[model samples]
Target: MPLLPTPSYTTSLLLSNGHVQTLYPPLFRKVAILDAERVRIATHDDDFLDLDFLPATAEAACPNADGVRARPLVIISHGLEGHSRRKYVRGMAACMNAAGWDVCAWNFRGCSGETNRALRMYHSGVTDDLHTVISYCAERGYARIALAGFSMGGNQILKYLGEHPAAVHPAIVAAATFSVPCDLVGAAKVLDRPSNSIYMRYFMRSLKEKMRKKKELHPELNIEGLDDMKTFAEFDNQFTAPIHGFRDAMDYWQRCGCGQFLSALRVPALLVNAKNDPFLSPTCYPVYTARASEFLHLEMPVTGGHVGFIRNHEDGCYWSDLRAVEFLRQHL
Candidate 1:
């Protein structure tokens, strides 16, 4: 398929800048999560992933005139330090439900408002957790499935598809992602900048707090010197790599970066990474991979910061959510 044309998302004059665009939604956007029935599924390793499901309304669940199946599922993955209830995830779930699809917004381990039981937690790569989610959905008899993810979760979707093109469930037909940090090595560099210190501190604070709680359960966990760590390099090297079975931060970034896996996606996938995303590196935009691949449709908009694609809509859906629903509906 041809690459997507440049999409338009106009922020207010006050929010035109990347940082403002990124910060406005979380600081101000409010999208109520209605009728989200939380389901907990146990992992093989005894860890758990929490999924918030919004089933398609009965009016929207009927088969199409063409007799296409009803109840197609869209599984959405959240960003780093994010959960199923984040505005981005909740908004997309609502949009999908409105468009006649069931939505499953999954929380990465330890991100579901409770620290995960296992000693280890989720990371940038970790497609195995996604596999467990997909497989669980498949077993539940959903005949059609699509995927949507943001940032770290987006990287996981691409890596999951690329790592196992032939191994993907037949039910999964399409995918859409926004603001992905696909190139982890470059993303680390981008996050280390002085301009991004706000984001760095916010994330480090959240991660460190989780570690403090996790330490209570797994006392062997080292929570020392977390106060000194400021960047992903410092924290990932000290904690994430050792706990998640990587040699170090560099090895984790190298092995887990989704840039190396884009060309291998079998399902029709839309990756819309904004050019002005403050949280991403230029390497995160895989122009070559998208050009070479038949399935991965990479759309680089001029402005969408991280997961923020604010749209002035009555339904409270953002531009990113609407765009994903637009792309995914074509396949469903």
Candidate 2:
């Protein structure tokens, strides 16, 4: 029953090609999100996370005015190199806010346009920062919480929920995710292909810049051959693995990939990974895992590409936005 129907998702006009669907939203989609009230919270690791709150405009939805409003809140986590205000994050925030749900879009370490104090940047499996955001919202008094994430953020949410299902927060009722790379090793192989070089270069450019900043801040850290490195494999092997305590890139992927953890999930989680997503490999679909689990629902649409569920709706809501709100409403 958890494996969902994919026909529910229809691509926007002329966005049938996988790459076209993947590239269209970031290049052309501009959504006007609700006004955000920003807040910064501390992490247990001596760093911080910036949270952008878009409160529901109900009669009494303010955070901790008298008490946290009894509204259900959707906490959104963004993708790799993504922050709270990215078009995709804000677009979903706008859609959810219109449906009367409070929104908290949290930024990963160093992603809020500020250099983080920690030497290590965010990774696919870093759930502690997410836990900090979730704990903040839960303690603030919101009665219900639903989680939504894209790409890396989605992987983090899945890993967090499945890592200790019996210990998950009570208020976190459901999760909805899109364009998730549940299998990092396989996904990386696909990403390394020449056909996906454009996306790879985009990622590498930002990553290299961040490493340069790290080098400037922590001269003791070694980054001697950083420039020559071009692929995620080379970069993650040298930096992402050792700094984050993984033995190697393969070790990082095996430990962090959410596919292995789905069976332990206790809450309802709908992972919508587009069949045409240029970022994923065949192992990412996780059809067998979802079929074996009661809580994990995997939906693979034939057309929508990486985070691209573009639907030219009169309301400006894409298929993903509509589907997320619908699924969350059913469970919340």
Q: Write the per-residue lDDT of candidate 1 for residues 259-325, one digit (tens) a residue.
A: 8988888889999988889988889998878888899998988887888887777889899988998
Error of 1 at 243 (Å): 1.2
Highest lDDT against the true fold, candidate: 2
Which regions of candidate 2 deviate over 4 angstroms? 58-60, 63-66
TM-score of each: 0.95, 0.97
Give, for candidate 2, the lowest lDDT window spanning 10 residues.
58-67
Q: What TM-score does model 1 achieve against the real structure?
A: 0.95
In model 1, the worst 10-residue window by lDDT is: 60-69
**Regions more than 4 Å wrong, model 1:** 58-69
Give me candidate 2's TM-score against the actual structure: 0.97
